[model samples]
Target: MNLHHNLTKSRLRAAYLVALLTLAYTLSFIDRQILSLLVEPIKHDLSLSDTEISVLQGLAFAVFMGIGGLPIGRLIDRSRRMSIITAGVAFWSVMTAACGLVKGYTGLLLCRMGVGLGESTLTPAAYSVISDSVSPRRLGLAIGVYSMGVYIGAGLALIIGGAVIARLPVDTMILPLLGEMRPWQVVFVAVGLPGLVVALLMMTVREPMRRHDESFAVKIPLSQVFHYLREHRFAFTSLILCQSFAAMSSYTLNAWAPSFFIRSYGWSAAQTGHAYGITIVVSGMLGVVSGGFLGDHLVAKGFVGGRMSLMGAAMICAIPFAASAPLMANPHAALLMLGVITFLITLAIGTGPTALQELLPNRMRGTVNAMAVLTVNLIGLGLGPTIVALLTDYVFADPLKLRDALAWAVPMMMLVAAIFAGLSLKPYARSRSQRLLTQQPVENA
Candidate 1:
């Protein structure tokens, strides 16, 4: 009876931890994605170019997220993850709201940088905590559940931002003290304020203890982290390449999809929001859940190659649809195509990350993830949208031609990402096999 009761308690604790991580992920994405929805209004109000908007949306945030990840990852490894995450949520929440108060590009940039810094604590801490709390068998599912937060939060942001901006009187609204701010400012406030509630909820959650203690005595130095990468050249290269290209392609679509709809199909913000919100929710939810299920199924069948297979397939299948996105005649057609592409593209994200976690030791996992995110965000998110903007501005040179330019850029990136996904297979499978081998003797004992 005692044993059964203890098992029940353990299961409940695991469920609770998953819920907390999901909430953290949701807030992280809400803060991150709110800027995307406000891009048009912010650009018009600030008289910013596409390149400038890219900097606001991607570069500033990526820089801060990259720089902040290492220290935050270290803290999460040593300190209480719940507290770190709570503080981070609070910090970003406040900064996101502060964005509403900023008038010029300089102020907004600084506010975005702050949002990046605060959000940086999320992935490393949350990933580490989930890995520690959940059993390995369920890691992919936990990651999938967490990944849902991105779609859910992003979808909600678009819906909420669209509704508020559409209904609000942007031309006439004037603040008594600060004068007239755009409707976009109000949208930011609305989206950013809810994070305070999330942060408060986060504060009440308990941090779980680390699972492995044998390696705790010898602190893993940064050099050792690099050395481990140096030792496993193939795995290191595969992880970096896969993450970088995938993130590039993913961010490209996410950053520009709404604008694409408006430009190509003459859709309103509210219409685009509803279409994207519904599509993302349905397809993203399905893809992530299916990816987790597929990964577990493959792994259970003694096919350590599951992660690579799933990722490669997703990228390959997504390419044609993504490439054809701009060519669709109407909004409904474009959305249908985009829905399929998003589902396939997002399918690989969580699986790849969870696979990486399985490869690294617990102590080194956070450090490696930080490094991965640094490369992925800096090169992928930071450069991808910027490159697309530059290409649209320079190469395309016509507003009417911008959709074609985006189409060209995204498909090419997806193809490149697929190649990297293929390249990741051998190393990932080998690493998993080796890890299983290393654990066998201990299991036998």
Candidate 2:
């Protein structure tokens, strides 16, 4: 009876902590994505071009986030996880609100960088917490729940940004120090300030006990972490790079799908935002859930590298639909195809992270995850928008060519991602075997 009571209490705590971290994840994406909706207004106000706006949207934020994740990753492995998360929430939230106060492109860029750096602390810690708290049998589903924040936050960003833009009067003063600001500027504040509440919520979460972890090894230096990664280069490299190429394709869509609709179908930003945001959230929820349950089920069934294989299969299956969706003449038909593509593409997110935690020792999870974050940012976030912009600005040159550029770019990226993920199956299987062998002695002891 006492054991049962303690288990129930532990489960409840895990649920609440997961819920808070999920909220934090949602807000980070919301803060990150709101800028996408503001592109036109920001461009007009700042007198910027598509290329420059791409830099602001992805590159500027991604570079700093990637760089910052390294040190934070090491810290998460060693320090109190909730404290790192709580402070991160506060810092990013303030920076996000500060975005509303920026007077020029440079100021906004710096603010965006701060937002990125603050957010860099989140994923490693969240993953570490989830891995420690959740049972291995249910880890995939738990991670899936956590990952839902990605789609939910992104969807809300579009919905909220669109709603704000549609309803807000230009330059209405809310505070005395802040005079009249543009509607887009006000959106940043509206989205950014809520994170403080989330920070406080994070403060309430107890640091989850580390399981399947080292006794004193969390304090290992960063160089030693790199040496461990160096020992398993192929598995980590393929996993990170595989997901990155796929993510690049998704990030491309996230950054410009609204623009695509506006240019190609002559839809208003509000219309695109409403439709796309709804589709992403609903479809993405289904995909993320499927990934979590299916990945765990497959592994339990003795399918080696099932997670990587599942991600690869989904990406491959998504390719044709994502590629052809933009080229459809009928708007409804195109949107329907896009909805399908969105669901299939999102299957990768939930599986990959959970599988990654299973691969490495607990002491190394935070740092390696941080390295993965860096690689994803540098490749996917940094280059996705830039490549799309280059294609649209230089190669296509015509107003109607945006859809064509995406049709070409997205499929190619997915194809390469599928290949890399497929190649990783054997390495991942070997690594998983080695990891399982290490675990048996520890369990026996």
Top lDDT prediction, candidate number = 2
In the range 1-445, model 2's lDDT, one tens digit per residue, is 9978888888788788778888899999999988887887788889987788889889999999988999899888888989999999999999999999988999999999999999999999999988888778888988898888888988899888888787876555566678878888898999999999999888788888777765745477778888878877888888888888877987888898888887788887678778888877888788888999999999999997999999999999999898799899987788788778778877886688887888878888888889899998888899998888888889987646889888999999899889989989999899988888887332110
The positional error of residue 414 in candidate 1, measured at the CA in angstroms, is 1.2
In every candidate, how many clashes are there?
0, 0
lDDT of candidate model 1 versus the reference = 0.79
Cα lDDT computed for each candidate against the true fold = 0.79, 0.86
Could you report the Cα RMSD, in angstroms, for every candidate shown?
2.2, 2.0
Among all candidates shown, the one with the greatest TM-score: 2
Runs with alpha carbons beyond 4 Å of true place in candidate 2: 170-175, 214-218, 440-445
* Colliding pairs, model 2: none
Candidate 1 residue 255 C-alpha distance from true site, Å: 0.6
- Per-residue lDDT for 384 in model 1? 85
Q: How many pairs in model 1 have backbone atoms within 3 A of each other, for residues 3 or more apart or on separate chains, i.e. clashes?
A: 0
